[model samples]
Target: MIIGAQSALAQIIDIPNPLGPEGLTIPGLVAKIATWLLEIGSVIAVIVILWAALVFMTSGGNKERVTQARQTLWYAIIGLIVLLLASGVAELIKNFLTGNYN
Candidate 1:
């Protein structure tokens, strides 16, 4: 059952699941999902940055390609910025929800 799986996962993570309880707490779920998303986002962002750099390096003086690479690099940088902001926001939300602020 889904409940059994949730409880098992909760135990593995050391989050409590009262022997007969239903599910993990909302904040715990949010934190777990946010952590996954942030990790994926960071990996994608790094790949994009590398791809953009490769494009820029291989442009070979072609104005259009150079421009395209520049645009791609700028977009990747923006995406990284957004991801960084989201990471901070996620931490804030998780901390607020769990009352674990510093």
Candidate 2:
């Protein structure tokens, strides 16, 4: 009885697909890649901002360190803006191709 129960419990079960049925298509793959890039870019932006803030806080009135931190912060901000714009452009292209835009 124990062996039989163990065999029954060990039976393979199919798990439902997480990305739904459309995940296998080209558009779905492109969207997934774009989403991942955006997420990673946002994370990098946050890290850069935090590092700049830390540098600014610990500069102790040093002009060079303060200048470096300012530059870093500005660059990170610009990168974040560009990332946002890219994401918007991708969305627009996808909409246009799908004929979903009004």
- Backbone clash total for model 1 is 0
TM-score of each: 0.69, 0.84
- Which residue pairs come into collision in candidate 1? none
Clash pairs, candidate 2, are none
Poorest lDDT segment (10 consecutive residues) of candidate 1:
1-10
* lDDT of model 1 at position 11: 42
The 10-residue segment of model 2 with minimum total lDDT is: 1-10
lDDT per residue (tens digit) for residues 1-102 in model 2: 354455756878898887775456878878888999999999999999999999999999999999999999999999999999999999999899899987
lDDT of 2 at 100: 98
- Give the winner by TM-score: 2
Estimate, for each residue in 4-97, the C-alpha lDDT of model 1 and write its tens digit.
4455456444666652267677666766777888889889988988888898899898898889988988888898899889889878886887
